[model samples]
Target: MHFLTHNTAPCDSTFSPLYSVVFGCILALGLPLNAVSLWTLLRHHSLKSPSAVFMVNLAVSDLLLVVSLPMRVYYYATGTWPLGNLVCNLITMLFHNNIRSSAFFITFISVDRLLAVVYPLRSRHLRTSSNAWKAAALVWLLVLVINIPESMHFSKFLKELNGSSCFPKTPHRSPLHYIQPVLMFSMLAVNMVCTALVSWTLSRRLNDSARVNNKVNVMLIFFLNLVMFIICFLPLSVGILSTNIHVRPLICLASVNCCLDPLLYYFCLDAFWKKKEDVDLPGEQQLKDIRSPCVGLE
Candidate 1:
């Protein structure tokens, strides 16, 4: 069912300008955002919520992709991969790992927020930082195990006709190829469900003004995450389903997710709304005063 030829010609020179622009933008934006996110998460001890932990891991995944961009940019700039087989394979591996790992971590963030809103009392005990760390660890392990073989075999996918292209050129079918489409859609389904449920639950709490504001804040944060998920992944997912479409550009577009992730940090970790409100309302002030004496911070 591989409709596209495996050994497609070397990418046209016309495409290199687009690739260079895209890769350059990703590099310029993704690195500093991820770096600042990593720094802020580590420095601010108050930022260690369950969802924040997932954001931290997401930043890590984005940083990996950012670090690998220069080589990709160079390849596009020259219209070839002169970096030899090992570097090419490793770069391909980074791209593969970054996308899936980002998806899984964002999934965790969505579910974590959904549980918090849906089962507030239970979520207090259930959503611990230790558990978040454990979950993040498991995601890394799973992604690495699933991706390592494909990455190691990336060199085999290349053909040296016009020049060495890292993208696969043969029309042969493989289990990984089949599994990828399934995985993309499966994760996408979970994200869409979680987003819908979280939004619905938050909408119901709008009657309680005090809780309403907080719920709205959390809901908006989740909404940002959901929007990013669709913006980054939906096209790639669609391309996978429609096998005739060349997916490399969509893949590059998806990488922009890492850059947008820092927006979540600003919204969630920085307490943007809370700071702006600054306990301006009497009810909010009273609530803050009441909660201020508590042993644990939210």
Candidate 2:
């Protein structure tokens, strides 16, 4: 999806193998991680917390990208899109939508943590599970609205290619292309602010062991969110701004975030990796002891 002038030349042979290998790895890792994340969120009733709700939505977004990778892997490996135009458009849209939705959800998680850590009592009313669900709904709606035109633009196959090319470099730049960099940067800024505030809050609690530990956990959540933005979304945003940079490899790098997202789930949800028995143990005291830093259940 690098913006290039419409030309008949086939995609760079060198990058095709790279895409196949990278996308294959993403599919292999992302599938099980997100699957288990989703399962844990539902099976344990983790959705009681707003952060858990966002985590569930994030896992779903990652799975959307994971399931679409097989076809992308096939196309890159064989240099053809046997799936045809409709599927091509769909895959393209899914890729973009996943990227945008993932960014938004990750930011939501960070903001959830910020509220939980910095303004716990005050934000309690705003951080309800219902509000989280509403926020997730808005993210999906915004992603769909942004990608609709891109899907229409992507509907046509590149006829000049030797065979079907699902995402050949197109010379024409859609207005949406310009919007992506701005969106990525804005999300990055939000994550950074959340991370900073969480870190500062942690510093204030160093003398109290339990509160410090809890604040550290909150810091870790925001830190990972910032890292995801920098590593996954930064290059693609930069690539979108500069035509001289190759965007295909950046896109592949961006896809790596799908695998990395499970880390957020593990850290954001205290019950994500805990045994079912442990999570189900009786008593509100036990639950409070293990409450996620993002939940501010205390």
Candidate 3:
């Protein structure tokens, strides 16, 4: 979304209003959705499952982005950045961090499910809750390490633009110029490979009516990740490599991933809920015994 706003070529003013609306909508939807998701993961589900661990990390990443939206909304709405360069850099860092972190966590979840279906016995040790949490920690640590250059140089870019508004601009041949596209495309590739594996495994298991519901639920996970990759990740990744594209809107569009991710939670947990429902409660079992009037118990 960065363009050289020199006197020869003034920045487009129209994008400010559009950005305002987009950020506003993202804040409205993303905030509540992520909050509830975090609560559900922490309160209802123990983070002992690999899926739950990945989801909780995803929710935490989304909340980090969600918290930064207010400043973005203000910047766009007022068409200014009264906030200092430090605040601006922090906001930019959070934005990029969430995008990368979310991508990794989503890919991890896809692979986790794929392994669960494809190599249930072998993957059992690999997919433990402890391993999942360790993976999550590694993702955060790696994201911070990778993004340090961006954090250090972000304010400089804003200062160079010499505008009242502060937005991330990609300068050709810069460090970020190389890093973002590479990272995004890598995540996209991993997601595609994982999705293909999940699909193949599910297809092979499709004939088993006993596991039909479970397979369908897992397939939905692939479908959603594909959708997220297409709509959010693809454009941004490709656009970063091309000078002709204005990437600002696409970056904002990526925020939709936060809201959409909760849908994955629903699908992933479908099997869990089904199993819960299928199990008879102790009280129900007692009532059945009373109704049957077992001779010895009577």
Which scores higher on lDDT, 2 or 3?
2
lDDT string for model 3 (1-298, tens) is 3344422233534237678888899999999988987887676655556777888899999999999999888776655567777787788778778888888998887777656655655665787778988999999998888677767666566677665556744422246656666766777788778767655655554445534654565557667887887888767766767766667877887888888888877654533232221211133242232111000101
Model 1: which ten-residue window has the lowest total lDDT?
289-298
What would the per-residue lDDT of candidate 2 be over residues 217-268, giving only the tens digit for each residue? Answer: 7677767777778878877766766656667777788899899998876664
Candidate number achieving the greatest TM-score relative to the actual structure? 2
Q: Which scores higher on TM-score, 2 or 3?
A: 2
In the range 1-298, model 1's lDDT, one tens digit per residue, is 2323222435433226577778989999999989988876666544446776787789999999999998777766655666677777677778778878888887787777666655555556667778889999998998888776775455555544333565432232335656765676777778678767756665655445644655555567556666666777666655655546666677787888888878766655433223221211233332233221010123
Q: Between candidates 1 and 2, which one is better according to lDDT?
A: 2
Q: How high is the CA lDDT of each candidate model?
A: 0.65, 0.72, 0.68
TM-score of each: 0.78, 0.83, 0.80
Query: Which RMSD does model 1 reach against the true structure?
Result: 6.8
Ranking by TM-score: 2, 3, 1
Q: How much is the lDDT of residue 269 in candidate 3?
A: 52
Off by over 4 Å in 3: 1-15, 168-173, 206-212, 269-298
TM-score of 3: 0.80
lDDT of 3: 0.68
